[model samples]
Target: MTYLVNDSADFVDESIEGFVAANADLVRRVHGGVVRATRTPPGQVAVVIGGGSGHYPAFAGLVGQGLAHGAAMGNIFASPSAQQIYSVARAAASDAGVLLSFGNYAGDVLNFGIAEERLKADGIPCRCFAVTDDVCSGPADKAGERRGIAGDLTVFRAAALAAAEGKSLDAVHDFASHANDRTRSFGVAFSGCTLPGASEPLFTVPESRMGVGMGIHGEQGIEEVDMPRADDLADMLVDRLLGERPNDNQRAASPRVGVMLNGLGSVKYEELFVLYRRVSQRLEQAGLTVVQPEVGELVTSFEMAGVSLTLFWLDDALEAAWTAPATTPAYRRGGVPLEGEPRDADDFAAIHEQAAPPSSEASRSDAAGVLAVIEAIQARIEAEADDLGKLDAISGDGDHGIGMTTGTRAALAAARRAVEKGCGAGTVLTRAGDAWANEAGGTSGALWGLGLRCVGTAIGDSDSVAAAAVVQGIRDATDAIMRLGGADIGDKTMLDAMQPFANALAEQVEAGTCLREAWRHAAKHSEQAAAATAALKPRKGRAKNHSEKSVGHADPGAVSFAMIVASTATTLESIHEDVT
Candidate 1:
């Protein structure tokens, strides 16, 4: 089915805009995301959850006084950037720190990790708990490496409810982590979904087949098999989930559980009810009492033809939270006490109107040069986005190309404005990085923003530009990326290319090479490093789910970095030749 949208490129922003417009009573717009319209108590911990835009109730639809305090939405199938996460957290800040929660995908980890660091640096303590509940993604021994699907709801609800109960940050994190450990989910898809503007679905299943154990980001199932009858599907899901109850709960006698039969997208409500009927009968037969069973689309991929079942093993505390009142746009439970009377929020829109500081004439001229580099990078990103997305689709959610294209175009627009305004190198880069992070909203976007800002800080607006300065900037950016992303050189991230480039550039420049010549030499090392990633197993990001299948495919981040650097080096060399 074709989606009704005004502009394909404006889909995410417009969707968020419409969400805020319709849910004004429960949520309000913030700088980089949305927050609850009603304020929380002064000392209450804020639970903020987020990810890509395609998952509905998991993010914006759940922002309310008793559920998530805020949500940072990103482009479809991409993780929200660090800047977006931080802004949403800041809008929801209180005397108590923030508890940032999301699915345990690679992009979410990187972006949320950066936001947590920034929040702490700004005098607000923060903690992150990533949900890992997809049973088919990994074995119980390695659950931490699994991808999160519908289980994001159970974990987020537990944390948000604990926070609403005035629990400490530690308690919030504990409860969320506890919920993740206790929750298990399994899913099967009959067909894939198409993005808003896409002509076809991300992937397809045979007419007589079904995709088993799938992710929420339009990712195809791990294994395909013959389609089964509705009752057979229910039995299969219940048996598998019950077979591997959390280690601690497996020993409990008559363990009560909260059952959720979720529809991904295209699966109708009546269909879910039919499945739930069989599921409930099986649980009863197994001597497990179902507490507060739910059958609905709590989280979804865009029009995906699939369904998933989540079993949240309930204890005294978990059951209490499960029944706790929650009020949001798409979900509402018992009457939750409202924090405050709904109020007008006319003052929150000032976050986008920041002014860049003045800089020297030479620095402003250099900023114009940086703008050219950004344009070249944007062009390359646009040309290769589809290929990059295809690489990511092999194991990831398949939005890398879109994220990169959107982020680079945004960065170029910002840098051009800064250059015209007579800004310095640092100011130009800072503005561009912020724009990139906010627009792209993914793991690569957040890290790239951090790296750019680090480089900008090292190359001060007041300093003289030289080979030493550029080397220092590259080294600084590399370190910041490592610190923020928690990935070493072999983790198959953008850092794989970044580290080698910095090293080569530093060595060449120290030995009296000009900036352009040194840059060309460094770009060679970056390209080689990017290509070498094909042989390594991914330990981080979405690719980790299919660790073995990811072998022989160079990471998209590493590949993009090599292209940007190589292109920039060529532009610089041509400029040098003209000047001579």
Candidate 2:
């Protein structure tokens, strides 16, 4: 269990603040995350890598000379927001362009992909690459769908090294992609990790047993087995990786490989060294030359009793990058040559809120209604946060409850501020959406943010809100979510409820039902749809990695969506009753 924390909600922010203060010489705090203390040289590609917090040295710790130019930090076990990624990239990019790299998780893919689009729209060159290197997550034929684990170290190093060598953006991206293709990792956990202020760990393993194919984000392992001796575990890991050797390296003359025996938080360095001794022997017996094998913590979960072994099949270029000098807060190679001057104090950009658009008296009245509904949603989420988190833990990283609570709280605050400014319902929702995305920073956050924005745009600031307008807004939001999330109605996601709710509302509105009556009917459809998800297997997100475990459990996202819509229906009915 995490022992040192003051207000679990403020944990990530406080940790980042303290980390920057401790490593001020190498890293500087930016609006969204951290960047190298020194500026990037002109005409050199800037490599930015990131994901959720809690994976210590992987992100912030790797931002310095000969490594990542910056890192966009996110909430624990969540992806950084698109705005966060964009801010970090803008702060780090040079004339050559920027290369964004991260794990191939669903949240990371969506957020980083959006950031890449934004960079291009602003006339800044950018390319994003998702590292898929964990063999346990997918089959060899579908390697592109695998999750990235400790093997991310190899890909990040390749891109950063190429950038440091003054390579162009394309070249840096290619190097990173190549490294990702050659890298393969497998992990195991003896026990799960507990989040800050949580009463229990995310998952538990049987005594004298180990969970195999575990993820770094507090997800339960795919399989369970009796714990093995140190040497036996080493043999098992080495043999598994050897079976996954890149096709090109299968017959190479004196093939070289870079190894990283990464500890996933609480595992001691002494234990790793003991395991590495046997790993080294096995590699030598296989006639493979190991180059600069790293044996310690690199990418870690918060105090997870787990370890992962990454085998980076090295070619000439990869080997050179592997051996290149690097200097960062937590990692360093040989001596590194300093090139650029210290970063300018004025480089960190400040965010300012935009003025609210003018609104009519009738529109202001509608805004009040919007605020009331958001307040109800926030309360419902807070009341059900623990249950939602436990439900998600069956197959996911168990951060859904935290994400929903944070997003809704921020959205509610933004809505209230907008109401004070006399904004219309549409403008209020737009501001709320922005706040939700910026604070929550994950797949659900991005989806809810986008959906809210779409609905707001569809329902313009008119004198009165009509049932037809509400139905249209629901349809627009549902469409946008489906497009962005790449999930269909039966994917065991929030869409399972959202689609049915939208359809039911549209039908009732077309039948001339009152807005309150239509909404109440729609809420029932959503609730029923959410409940139906228990019989379906998840086909997206972290839960997809353990589809079997997800059976008989509704998606946390679907349940939360149902809860919000149901509560909003009550709020609408109460408002109508008070007006009458």
Candidate 3:
């Protein structure tokens, strides 16, 4: 049974309670679920925002100095009731009046509309602005039907500045609407997410695949496709966004662009950077100058592994507001540039040029063992691609299954060629790592390649790997992974399995066990250790938000590594028996 808190009914209030408790200096809970910034000066145009509870920083966290003046918090994945919106509006209003900003959704529209009536009846001047920037959410022919994604940030910034400048409600509303019209967003999700206090996720996605146009609430997407490399995925998202460029044929000659790389909760900052590099490269290649690009977790779904790309066609007015100094917990500007061109071309070229070449002195027997291990791992990954993808959907980018399968297949082919050419085991492993790194091109590729090289280095010139050699090799590989990724044991990573396996092998080797027997013991211990990771809260990696939920799921990397080791040990044993 899935472990989850069944507190959905109280999720909204409880979350707000925590939010207010932590941000008491910046904001105060007024009436209903409305939170208003204590720093909002009177007589300024008040900007009020509202949405569901899960998308923090959207409708609630944005309420602070230089941000939203007030926010109406809603239930998890549900729109706030009209009464809540009305309460927020009344609390935030001044002589200049209040401007309501929110994402475009049916429930939000219905509820906010009712609130608008109540606010007007109470003699509060109010206007509404809805953000509908997701190009993938709606058909091109009916752009109005698109849902809002990350573009809400741009809309809120414009409205808040207009209000801060003491403009009337009408002026702030107009500016917000204009920002919404100019902005466009597209997103892809590898997995789905569970609402607070829910036993199951709201939806499910297949393994080795991604759902384009997925909504923040686990809504179905336009289509699912085989998971591609970061560059390929970035290209697809950027191309779609560029295709929807507002027909400025008659309006402006050179349109500056503002890009926001939004993480959907589960993706790590490092992985996001990998994706951002591709995005900036694509934008530069398209001849569109990015005035300023925002990266990080500005918008998110609760631990959902996805990313959204937002492009705002900037004018002088909007650019001024965007570039204006602002401070918040999650969003910031003017510290260090998060995205930029490569600083050193020479360093970049050196790193890229370190590809491994085919080996020169591998024997047939050694080659066979390596090939067997590669084939077994590849076959397993292909077979479980869907399952891995599904599991990842719950807490990470769902492409683990597909990414591993594709990479293993490529690595296997490289290994086979190296073996056929009589290369040594080390050379074969090096070539395989290089092939996987170049062809697969993602977090997993770099990791798997590093592991292969580690193993190859430990094996050195051994005709047959002994239990001690294998354990040392795995230790070396683990060290490489930790060095490259900065992930340690209990981080819900493959190291959970690897550490235990290495220890078990070392113990068995010390006890005078045969290589095959030691492997059996290690694989068994590794499986238990992998399963044990389900109880660990993720301290690192992309699934940091849902660290709690990731407790019960085995680390995908660990499981795969165990399988490869077990297969190799068994194959080597069989070869020994044949020789005897």
Q: Could you say which candidate leads in TM-score?
A: 1
* lDDT pick, better of 2 and 3: 2
Tens-place lDDT per residue, model 3, 105-210, is 7456545655675578678787777789999776777877678778998998898778777787788898898888889999989888787666777676788899
Candidate 1 local accuracy as lDDT?
0.84
lDDT of each: 0.84, 0.87, 0.72
Report the Cα lDDT for residue 550, model 1. Answer: 78
**Top-down TM-score ranking:** 1, 2, 3
Q: Write the per-residue lDDT of candidate 1 for residues 1-580, one digit (tens) a residue.
A: 4368787788888888888999888899886678898876777899999988887877899888668999988778788888889889988878899999888877788889888988998899899988998898888888997788888888888998888778999999999999898999999998888888788887777898898997776454568889999999999999999887877635457779999999998998999999999999999999898988889998888888899999999888888888888899988888876785454655364544466686776676677677878888899889999999999877676778988898899899999888777788778888888888878777788877887777777766764455676677788889878876778989888889989999999998888778898889999999999999999899876676578887899998999999999988866632211111
lDDT digits (tens) for residues 1-580 of candidate 2: 8999999989999999999999998999986799999898899898999999989987999998888999999888789987789889999988889999999888888888777876897888999999999888888999998898899888999998888778888888988999999999999998888888899886777889998987886555568999999999999899999999888735568888999999998899999999999999999999999998999999998888889999999888888989989999999999887668877767875544467787666767888888998999999999999999999989886778988999999999999999898888788888888788889999989888777776776656755555666677788888767765678977899999999999999998788788798889989999999999999999888788689999999999999999999998988753322111
Runs in model 2 lying further than 4 Å from the true structure? 165-168, 249-251, 357-365, 390-399, 422-424, 460-476, 506-521, 545-553, 570-580
Q: lDDT at 508 for candidate 1?
A: 88
TM-score, per-candidate, Cα-based: 0.92, 0.89, 0.56
Clashes per candidate, residues 3 or more apart or on different chains? 1, 0, 6
Q: For this target, which candidate reaches the highest lDDT against the unseen true structure?
A: 2
